[model samples]
Target: MTQDTSTRTHCPYCALQCAMHLQPGDDGTLTARPADFPTNRGGLCRKGWTSAEVLTVPDRLTRPLMRKDRNADLVEVDWDTALDHIAERLLTLRAESGPDTVSVFGSGGLTNEKSYTLGKFARLALGTSQIDYNGRFCMSSAAAGSVKAFGLDRGMPFPLTDVGTSEVVLLAGANPAETMPPMMGHLSAPTLIVIDPRRSATAQAALAGGGMHLAPRPGTDLALALGLLHAAHIGGHTDHDYVAARTTDFDRAWEHAAAWWPEHTEQVTGVPATQIRAAADLLGRAAAHRSAYILTGRGTEQHSKGTDTVSAWINLALALGLPGRQGSGYGCITGQGNGQGGREHGQKADQLPGYRKIDDPAARAHVAGVWGVDPDTLPGPGRSAFELLDALGDGGGPRAMLLFGSNPAVSAPDADHVRARIASLDFLVAADFVLSETAAMADVVLPTTQWAEESGTMTNLEGRILRRNRATAPPEGVRTDLEILSALATRLGQPAQRFPTDPDTVLAELGRASSGGAADYSGATPQRLDDGEALYWPVRAGSAPTPRLFLDSFAHPDGRARFQAVEHRPPAEDTDPDYPLLATTGRLMGHYQSGAQTRRVDELTAAEPDAYVEVHPDTAARAGLAHGQWARLTSRRGHTRARVRLTPTARLDTVFVPFHYAGEQAANNLTNPALDPTSRMPEFKVAAVRLEPDPAP
Candidate 1:
């Protein structure tokens, strides 16, 4: 039944970025159905199945706009006028308040082509060092933690499919069933090690399928990780050969773990001592197999202690001499589609393209040469997301901002503060398919093309580079992200000449920057992606990118993984007398972050149109709340009211909310702003709150 419609491609909903073929109906409807591929295997999630509808939504933007005054409504404007407005404002701002007062905010959703070019434009043209992106809240901690321990921070050093062969899988802080369900074929056992404060859908699926659920207290994953590593020491599981030959300061790391044995870590993590020891033994035994993968996810990354938790996870794997082998290594299951590639391209505040730190002289030289700019002129290591936003105004913050493909108003940690900062901006422009919550606050909104109308590439969680081919022509007035960047850059008189009017040229620039770097993509040219099968990263010239990582040598300086000495820290907010319950938030299978695109889809909207708190019956009873009834959830940070749904899925004292809804029901509105000092990510997973009946009204 297969036809010759292989010319089209689509993006997988998760970070795996599995490139797929789109065979439009004979009548020309561009709906995407799964096609068999090596990585995806014809398996797609609910989100991916409906992704095709996103491009055809009725509210999609289709023209440029500008507003003359703060209270004035947006007026239709030509592309020239819009670009000119942006350029003139930038020039005026730079002259009046200096370069530091203006900055840009990029997104992980942007194509690798768009992402890398934006990094270059910011440093070379704007000459502002305050640029940052939304990824700082998501990818920074995982990246920093993995690099500190194993010297690499993409998802896995090994391909995810290798998880099936392992004896035991540590499902710590990750919910693949909901996050990336298609990959579950990698797990052969139901009794994989599941760790989370909340027995989420992933844990529940594992339990129903006969898996082990190790429920730890919120914000204390580091403790359980410490306990397991300590058990590795006591159980004689430590790889002394790998430690001494391939690692540094073995004695110091062991001593650090010994100081907080399983018993002590039990206190911090709320897991019994016996359970901790048993889990460690299980991991050690399973690791002996040919392909065991330790996967980390958002549960471990979105907090301030995010890095340390990631390091501990990697340390546990290193103790067994796991990494740099076939399927036995530490990996992170990145959330955003381009979470890996986005960070690699330097959209982050503190890095350059190809996973190099901004301050690194060699990396600076490499990137500057790639961009054809003076290395000295390129600013290095700007503030992270929170700091960049907090720096707006008096202490020299970006006065003007250009946002693309993101809705920060609903998605940011403390949205009110983000709204205020955007309001304070001298000029703001947003380019998206619709008037997203963040875009609603913009001085001008430019209609932009969606995934179906764009052609480029995205790097997945497994480090696979896949094609994103256009399935349909963009709307009459809409344009691609690359086109927008190029046109706007030209208006600024510093056009991205190398990538002008060509996505392939932009990809070439990204490929060139990947040279001589850890995430080499020279072989991942537009040509290789054109081939049928999926290829993993570390792509080199005239050769293959390694399908799975750590087949031989680790990326660490010594070619072996290091056991990090990680201690535990509690979540910033904890339940007390007034806030006597714990609250956790995450995604729903029916909706995505901010719900801007999905909510617009009628079918998706009907499935879950409103927000509700998942409350355990016992907790709901104690709080005078009932299923299908409204209740007020008050947290240390703020409060929100939602309809209650009694569900056994939630832990006794914890209430769960989905972050997809906006307005008063928005979970971020009630979430704490205290960030993981290390990751700068607002702690969306854990907060302290109390619930009560929504007063008689």
Candidate 2:
């Protein structure tokens, strides 16, 4: 009775999660059309248009595969055999080593239901505290910063639609122009301020006529933000009345920013004093008018000082009295598809499903009550992502790992090291639709259904939960991740009542688990999402959706935000005689993270076939490098080879590389694993490197 029917779902890519409709072709293929959802509003990015191609890729894993012996090739195996083998190994590993010897790694792309189940399975079933997700690399800094300031983290306190009505939009280190093209429409503000090291597409647009682009030196965003605050203070642009009434510790914040005047900030950041003054003036005008927003992206948040950098920006917003005002505030531009929701559902190391602290006895009891477990049995928080990976096979670290949905071999910082560590594990398992680079090294790889083949829910960047309905049946032999987790948990002696495979059943439990927490989702249900428009979180049952936060008061106990005094700090690695240039990593418009899924699509790969480095003309000349010539980029840790593209967009002392490829072209090979203390986010945005020409015979 299956006919070519059209189903509505959101894009499987970024946090924008643009809505789209899918129609099945006679050849069992699918095509997409823009859905009239409020977020994207019938707009589709290139990745969205070509997303369907992955569903039919020839190499899509359709059966469970296992490597019986170490160094042996993975052979196709039946589901029962694969599950039994993995369960036996896990139990044996636990019996030999303690439960702490086993760990679980998740992804930001997992749905709320999947994330909830994964976290519960790790704690309740596996009885391990070592569980975290790829989101550790994405927005952990922003989350940490927001929690320190407003006592909560929700990506954007207000919805995306608010951007179009704002009088000014200060976009720091975010290039949505290429990453989320459709988002450009929301940049309808009269003035757009873009802060970045290069003349990114978004910066170029701002430079054209929209507003201004402050091209600060790498690792100097903190200085620039502090300089702006200083300028506002000296120029009498701060809203003293509002600051005094709604914020605390303003005197310390002001003193910290006062140390970095325009002249001093210019010297440290490499941005002219005049530009800083102009940006401060524009921001001042916007604040006075009560219509502006300050947004942060990976460029500002992926660093050793990421939390401090975000805090610096938050201090500036508080000085101008922005956060709690209507149509005026600060937010983080989340990158991954479920980056907002994934963290809320408890996949993070120190958090529960409600975004509550894992160490909080009250939170532990609440979640334990929902899971029917004793509160004292829940384990304590574990190590962060990189630390967890680096501990693999160590003297007293995790010996067996269960990884799902992420391809750390290409996406993780110091990816070469991560891949080697993963290879050194006693046992590694990966569940993914494609045989990604990480999966290729696993002892067991489970074939799982992807976006259109699964029924679940994802929270967009706006904190709105949208349904991802099953459009068509998954290919034979492939199963849902929920099903895989269910089978494995049961095989591990867990009762069926605990690990349910049905999405709705898991969601019902999640709703109760997340109730009364920061990211409350008790109001949203599968039936509601299917019948009505997407609803934002914190919507308790019978309550309306909360599209805008902090409208009247902040999340703090006293209804006031805090202003932390943060000073500029040096990057983890600085350029020196050995590594005379800086290397920053990012993404391209054509390829998504790690290129695991997008690389399989013919169109996307054809558009960006190989990885390349962006070098400044002056830097290229000094190195005797030409455009399109292969070059070796050597960092303190390791080196990588990429084709060099000379352009003035790059600063002379810095080089840019896209972290999407694996093998010799992997940019993460040169990235620094130094992490931010507060957020544990690695300094993926900046690393010291040296470029040398490779003589291609």
Candidate 3:
């Protein structure tokens, strides 16, 4: 493809942000080809190659829609009518109740400019403190843990290229093989130690590569982490000099892990004691050579004690002197396309631009100055994502909401209850490229431009700011999200200049707003990004981008990392005789979150048409379940049915299900909503379940 015919952009799916070229054909067709980039190295996953198909799906929404009443069907309408009605309803709700009665919900897939604007509009136009995004459910536990340990949170402190030079890589609850096939190229040279409940493809790859795989029981990763630390201490692998010089509270943290001996941890986690010791030895040896990395994913950080679980692993990393080293550090494998940037901007309930605490007077003043508003005019921190959703339409809760780019109906835990709460809202407005499950329930739905149709910037997993160039024009009836937000702000009596539709102008304003904060993007201009500059943030104006962090000192005031005193705990709900099995949820190779876009693609749907329960053969036999037969998995929250697929790779006491399907097949239907106190992340990794066979007709 010639440069004139192809537009350089990143994939629209996961955080890897694999670079690709969108080439337009003579017949008005678009195709995706892998482009050379550091993260993916000229390789594309199946999802990335087929992503263009979603742009032309049959059900793609091309017109604004509105419903006269809750019981009525949504009818096509003009953009002016839809925006005018939505703005009027929002004003009425705010005037009748209060500004706090209106809320805004955002998504992780939004571009940096859009995420920044959504947060600003929620505070300035709607004058509401209730704003959060789906990203709170993605990696909040890891973000919280990282902040507690290092005083800052970036998904990866170093570039992805560092992984190739590591002697050993321990994946705690992460599976790159299926979720991000392109990332597997980096792991081929490392001694892979995979820790997961299921023998995922990553674990299989680890064993086949002469590495190790530790299959712990569901929600028992904290114990396993503590065991590794204890073994490291007893094995004379603790880096005493590094701990004394660069860290604080080490003694207190070590006290928490001292009691978790290998034997005891093995008993709790269902892994062999010998294997636990061996894994510890490998990590310690590799770290001593300064050639090891520890990375975590959703499996270990989706429990009621998720923050502590992540802290336990961080403690182990610190004991081995991992973080802040050249090739050795602890990081989180962020899942969403812009998950790192989505939370860093202002979408989170408790944050302002640049990952600044909204409650901080200085942060508020700085951002308010950029918006030309008084600092006190901005509301204080509001409820988190789940809390915000749970309180909808209740007394003293938000009555009206504006949602963008998210579908919580099929993705949220205790989904039936979330849907009920959504239904109870007095008014709801959704902006999307298609009629998603959540959008289907909205009083007004605004058709918006999607990935290739919009030009913007996204911060990838490595914190690098990359530009997404518009490859083709959007349908005439649809508008960009920025235009939708800008029009609503104008209708709310705000000047057009206050909320710009041009991405370049918004990004410049965002730079000013984020100038002095932790995730500073002051130097990431549209011109610089489009000029092919690889800018990673905390980029102050007139300064170079920061690629790696914490070489000589941590972000804390004392220039030292702090160790969190974390201990192991049982899951929110333990198994009983009535519910003797544990059910866990995860992603499939063919689909993305909530299955909104990928499900619309014929190839993706054909590869995985429906969700299925992965059960161990022994467990299946005990439950009288046979392969290909329908099984009803019931939990305290609700039940979902799926065809059984018996495999020896599954843990004997645990069952696994992909969480991409909707309605009866949704894995989230059986998940618990018990939340972590610190991060407020729900227990999506484990739920007590009972299985019964129901043969399909």
Candidate 4:
């Protein structure tokens, strides 16, 4: 009898990183089953259950392809030939233009090891300061807000289980009911206060649980949060003693909130003043008892004023003395699988490993020492994600680029412009398991192994470091991302020993480089993870893991959380005569970001085959549109078409569309690229758009 072959791993979808077990069948097929884990608790969503299908998708790329010439079709080539050609072009570009002329674009889906290696490769091998990732669009606002308020940024400072013990869970612009079904288990025990313009599934769940749902106008979350703060203060819910002892700058924050009041906020947000007072009362009461939590998601964090918007929410949490408490605090619901870790390990534009700023001399010396290079040899911080994309192939911008694991052509805000910029690149390279939209435009496309074929660590939404083991061998002619980076590093004249392809070795080096930094991981060795140890970050060698941060004191030198004095502002593009309605984009239950992987799965595609916009009946009637009819939504940036579905759950002045499908149906085509001044996050959650009936047959 043959022995059963199975391996334990995690899902490749969202930030929850639900644990799963993969078993190989006799007929060369694989199946995924939920495994007992802290985050998912042995439950898997449809996307998680069918994740194995992506590994064996029919159109999976297994060989290297290169464009022989400009305006030529891509042809299959050997690994050496592809690498040699890419190296030659990169060297020429660097010598003729400058190292800054070549850029690297990473993704949030990459494992910690890959993210670290990619960052190191961009700095050491390519000698370029231009490096950033799609994570900038995911939770940069929340990250910035958290760092400003608490002196550090972790998606969740506490374990996912903490929600179960909370009396109130205020979800600001977060919809876990559809995006992460398994997470709803934790929400079941807490009274939810959901804030969103549309009466989403999460809002419905809140109502079912006898909780409140505040449907504010799109991009007015900052005002709503300020009103909540004002009401909480007026009701004597402020923990005055706690604030005085554990926080600072409250006077300024209070002054700003004092002017908002409930009435004024109601006018801006369109949420009833009475509802604002009630919601504030619930949160204040819960926090007074030390059983409340506040959380923000992409909807509130993807705006032109996204950082300030998040700061407004953080100020409210701090006013109630939420941070540093055991059961009560503020957190962000990270979207991508490794979004938290990806930023910490140096894939971001302005960060080094361990979440250290690239511009810091001490951080440079520490990471440089680990790499056995001079600190001065490292480049300084460069442009952010959107800035990098917008500058591609332009004068004084990056002329060549190396991209991995991101489909910016579909996922980027103002995607039509991004596609044109990608097309303008003098040279481009992309590494992926399949030919994604961005990869299809590459001068060289290198096929890389999928998640199940690689063993690495991914930091989940709760900041817990989890290990995913290799379940099966990769297809022939394909390589792991580590191997690809290692080969490229060697081709670029870097020592082979510096770019080790082994995940374990790279992780150890990463720990060494991250030692003494903010996100210290020196103690999280491969052996500890193999021993089934649940490790969180900042785990110094010979010390215990920190499951919850700020339990006693914050990370700042004064050991006090800071209250940011922020004000609400209109979105980058407000409604006008040309565009009378607001359009917001989000994920669907069956389709993940960009739908590059999930769309290939037969079951998921069957469930949500096409992109559709949700419109209120009144709004549809006013626009002379009928339910299930295709409509054209036009914005200042561009336009897209989607079948309209009339539902009362939608606000009369707003429309909702799922941003998964690509091509003409992609919602991102209409998204604005106006960036948050601080986080550089595009205003994806709110856009001025006009809907009209499509006359096309």
Which segments of candidate 4 are over 4 A away from where they belong? 1-4
| Clash list (residue pairs), candidate 3 | none
- Taking all chains together, the TM-score of candidate 4 against the true structure is 0.99
User: Candidate 2: RMSD over Cα atoms?
Assistant: 1.5
Candidate 1: where are CA atoms >4 Å away?
Answer: 1-7, 26-28, 188-190, 393-396, 495-499, 695-697
How much lDDT does candidate 3 score? 0.93
Q: Write the candidate numbers in order of decreasing TM-score.
A: 4, 3, 2, 1
Tell me, what's the RMSD of every candidate? 2.1, 1.5, 1.1, 1.0
lDDT of 3 by residue, 1-697 (tens): 5457788899999999999999998877799999999999999989999999888988889999999988999999998999899989999989999999999999999999999999999999999999999998998999999999999999899999998899999999999999999999999999999999999999999999999999999989999999999999999999999999999999998898999899999999999999999999999999999999999999899998999999999998998999998999999999999999999889999999999999999999999999999999999999999999889885348998899999999999999989988989999999998889999999999999989999998988889998988999998898999999999999999999999999989889989989989999999987788788879898889999988888889999999999999888899998999999999999988999999999999999999998899999889999898998899899999989899999988888999999999998899999998999999999999999999885445
Q: Residue 313 of candidate 4: its Cα lDDT?
A: 91
Candidate 1's TM-score reads 0.95
Q: Clash number for every model? A: 7, 0, 0, 0
List runs of model 2 lying over 4 Å from the truth: 1-4, 695-697
Model 2 scores a TM of: 0.98
